[model samples]
Target: MSKKRKRVSRRRLAGQRVLAHVGVHNIETGEYKPVTAARRYIAESGIVPPALVNVRRNEHTTDRFFWGEKGLFSAQYAEENHFLFPSLREIVDRIGEENLFAGLEALASDDWEEMEEYEYAFV
Candidate 1:
């Protein structure tokens, strides 16, 4: 008799690393393929991608998102691009506990003045 195996769903597994590799033998030949790799990680421990709880400008990228005043849960590009657990503990492990908390606080205040002060120096 054949044995029956249990089946699993994609939701039960974490998102696979979205990666790609490309190379060209010669640029003159018009082969300009570009290589790519998972620039960030993903987490699908839930039935759906984590809801976007907050958003803020990267200071570097200037990407706009829901600010402190606009309290609403929406999927921001950044969150979607770097999806992770919907809990603080999980997020802290990736971004570091200190930075994670600071980010939350900063977004809560909708104040980027402090971030802006250092922006010029980075340039």
Candidate 2:
């Protein structure tokens, strides 16, 4: 079962400049590789990870219960679409809030088993 995200009264991360590395997650393997190197891997392999949300600063956000990073899911958008999400909240809009978080949490932790749990899981 997936954990429920908390409804915080206010987003504590507002206006905070956090140190973060850009990276991509293999939706199939739940593996995370930092960018440039990750870009090369994707190009040479011709495989696109379902999501690219691998930022280290937001690792703190994941510390709450699961590896939950609100703004991080955009890494995938950046990789696939060649641009970062203008609004991270849109991740919720596109993938659905629960799915964006849960899907990403699975990727962030390198949980290949959890990733493969899906019926359409990639080989």
Candidate 3:
């Protein structure tokens, strides 16, 4: 018999801000694509894990991706679920995506190191 998984409620902590949006991007063409396109690209390209591309959402938002054995996932999501995959945990520990991408605007911007540091600090 198969074990049923419990459905967990998605809740936000106080002061938490919702992301404006999430989507994929084509680096060469500089076009933003839907999430569905990301999945399709991963399947067709057969890219290796840990390979990723970045996309700029706006002046304040930049999205980062990590290619996994299963497919592409946001760095934040990969960190949150790293416990489920050993490879992911190693990548998160080594790359520190939160620190790496924070305040780093996309497209030739290298000011990430100048930004003020902040912690996740979930309650």
Candidate 4:
């Protein structure tokens, strides 16, 4: 008997408009810096295990990049490797593992008007 291959659905974000450049936030100091400045600071200070927060936006929605130990990851990646990320672990603890994906989907489908409340700085 032949094994059937599972089909994977790919979501596209090609039409999204970039609202801002990549920004780095220091988890300990709560400081936000542009990518270039963050790189310099990380190099000079030798910040242990530097991670980057990348944002992708469009006229309608936004997507955030989660920086893992291995590399940049999406929400799905964080779901799969929740153990590797502190934030995701905390979320799982609060919301339960099963509901994590549903919550993320809801957040992603939320109205764009709510996103306008905060000003996004273009680095």
Candidate 5:
């Protein structure tokens, strides 16, 4: 007789503000793809692939992150495309932890004033 395995629910990723919206970077080909639509597609399919690497941003702490099957819980996929977590982490680090969200959000939303308010030299 086979023992029954217990199933646990891990869907607690809603409502958390994702400060950095990173894309899927193909390390080998130097290609990058946005992860929004692909994430939607994966959600609808119900099958998670291993070869994806997206950065996992901490809601409260932007300096901390991890790597996993999906980009939400951890970093983006890596099995298929060469992993780019370290490099990505470096980029984030250069941007500074305190200003990570403010900087990225400003650029993503085209809110230059926000950056200016932060006293970012870029603005």
Candidate 6:
């Protein structure tokens, strides 16, 4: 059974990412040497990862809980689109984990499982 607990106020879901799918087109035979090369590029370029940007101003503010990295927005795109790493682990690692759960006394539900999954997932 799901246990009910007091809801914690969060600005947004932790480790949320704005996914940007850069489409690919068929190029010359020489350009697409191996199909797997594209996969390698995706893995390395970090486009697939949850790339985050601080959005909030007043970097000195102490009350803010989350990193205020503003994301890049195009005039054509919707405002809801934001960027983040592929998972929470990356976000925590990028921004010190200490800040993430600093005030919380107890760990959140699924915290352990989420961490485990993040650890095993490929880069």
TM-score for candidate 2, residues paired by index = 0.23
TM for every model, in the order presented, reads 0.18, 0.23, 0.37, 0.28, 0.20, 0.25
Give per-model CA RMSD: 20.1, 15.8, 15.2, 15.1, 17.1, 15.3
Candidate 2's displacement at residue 81, Å, is 14
Error of 1 at 8 (Å): 45
Considering summed lDDT, which 10 consecutive residues are worst modelled in model 1? Answer: 18-27
Sort order, lDDT high to low: 3, 4, 6, 5, 2, 1
Model 6 TM: 0.25
Over 11-115, each residue of candidate 2 has an lDDT whose tens digit, in order, gives: 121101111222234322225444444444455665433334332324343211111233223332232222123333343345553543343432223333332
Q: Which ten contiguous residues of candidate 5 have the minimum total lDDT?
A: 8-17
Colliding residue pairs in candidate 5 = 51-80, 52-76, 52-77, 53-76, 53-77, 54-75, 54-76, 54-77
Predicted candidate 4 versus true structure: per-residue lDDT over 18-113, tens digit per residue = 111123544222243333443455557554432444332334443444454454555444433344545434444566534433333332333233
Model 6 C-alpha lDDT per residue in residues 38-106, reported as the tens digit of each score:
333434554432232222223442111121223222212211222222343444556664665454435
* Model 1 misplaced stretches (Cα beyond 4 Å): 1-47, 53-86, 103-123
Clash pairs, candidate 1, are none
Report the lDDT tens digits of candidate 1 across residue range 46-89: 21222222112233322222111122222232232222223322
Model 1 error, position 93 (Å): 1.4
Which candidate has the highest TM-score of all? 3
Instruction: State which candidate, 1 or 3, has the greater lDDT.
Output: 3
**Model 1's TM-score against the true structure:** 0.18
Error of 2 at 118 (Å): 32
Q: Alpha carbon lDDT of residue 81, candidate 2?
A: 25
lDDT of 2: 0.31
